[model samples]
Target: MAQRLADLADQGCPNFFDSQRFGKDNSNLKRLAQWINGDINVTKRHEKSLLLSALRAAEFNRQLGQRVQNRTWQTLVPGDVAILDGSNSHFSVASVDAELSARAAANDIHPAGVLPGADDSIAGAPPLLAELMQRERLQRAYRPLRLRIQQLAWQFVADDLILTMRLPRGAYASGVIRHIFDLQSD
Candidate 1:
C-alpha cells in the first residue's frame, strides 16, 4: 500500500503516509523486569521469555521509526496535545483550559471492572474492540503549547535522538507524544 502511494504523482496519504509517528517505550520497563525475573517471589524462566518478547516489541517499534523517517509533521507544535480528530486530520491540539483540563484526569483513567449500572450486553461488539475500550486511556500532559503547529511553520526538524518530554506536574505529555516519538530502545 505504501509503495503504491509512493508511485502516485501527488504521493500518498498526507497525514499518515507522509507524517511522523512517534511511539513511546514504557518507563516501567525496568520495573516490569523486576516483577518478571528479578528474583522476585516465584520467578520462572517463562517470565524472562515474556520479558524478551516485550524487548522484541520495543525493538520492532524502533525499526518502524526508520520506515517513517520521510514522513512530515502535520501542524503539530512541540508542546501541543495532539489529539486524533478521527481519520480526517492526524490531530488537533486543544488549548488547555480549566474546562478542557477538568476532563483530562477522567479521560486518562483506564476502564477496569464494569460500571455499576452499565449494560453488559457487550453484544454486537468485537472482543478486541471491547478490550481496547477497557484499556486505560492516556492522559494529556502537554503544557499549553506556546505556538501552533502549522504545516508551513518551518522545515520539520528531527533534532534529538534522545527526546525528553517535560509535562506539567499533573499532565501526561508523554501520553500524547507517545503516539509520535520513538521512546523505545534500539
Candidate 2:
C-alpha cells in the first residue's frame, strides 16, 4: 500500500476541481444554467457569486478532462499556457522545447487550461462555454493541468492507511485521493 501511495505521489495527479465545488449533486451547475437561460433568477449577490464560480470551475474541469482523456494533461503542447510551479505566473507556449520539457518533468511548470471569461478570446473555446463567457462577462484565467504533491508521506496502522501531503491553495486533496482509491458518498 505504501509503495502504491508513493508511486502515485511520484506520478502526481490531475488537477481537477473536486465535485464538491459544484455543490451537492451538481446543483450549482444546474442553477447556473437555469439562471443563464432566465428560467430562474439569482438575486442574492453571494448566490450569484457561487453560481458564477461553479460555472467557471465546470468549464475548467471540462477542458482539463479533455486533456486527461487525450493523455496530454502532464505534457506540454503548442499553444498551451504553462504556469510556473508554486505561482500563478503563466505564459503561452508557442512551441515545446527541450528546456520546457525538462522543467515540466521536474515539476517546475505545468500545462494550464483556460477558465473562460469575457476578456478571454473565444477562439478554441467550445461554443457553449464561449457563449457563457460572453453572457456572464467573466474575466480570463488559467489553471494547471497537473498538481504536484509536496512533502508526501504515508504509513499504515492496524488496518488503516494514513497519508499526508501539502498542496497549493485551490488544489483539491480529493484530486490526489481519487488516483489511488475509489470514492463513495453516503
Each model's total of backbone clashes: 10, 1
Deviating ranges (above 4 Å) for candidate 1: 1-28, 32-42, 71-186
The prediction achieving the highest lDDT against the true structure is 2
TM-score of each: 0.22, 0.87
The residue-by-residue lDDT of candidate 1 on 1-186, one tens digit each, is: 223322221221122111121223453335344443433432465643343334333333332333346331222323334332211122333444554343322222110111111122233433432332233221112122111122211122465333333332322333333333424424
- Number of colliding residue pairs in model 2: 1
Against the true structure, candidate 2 has what lDDT? 0.83
lDDT (C-alpha, whole model) for all candidates = 0.29, 0.83
CA lDDT, candidate 1, residue 111: 9
- The alpha-carbon RMSD values of the candidates against the true structure, listed in the order shown, are 14.9, 2.8
Error of 2 at 80 (Å): 0.3
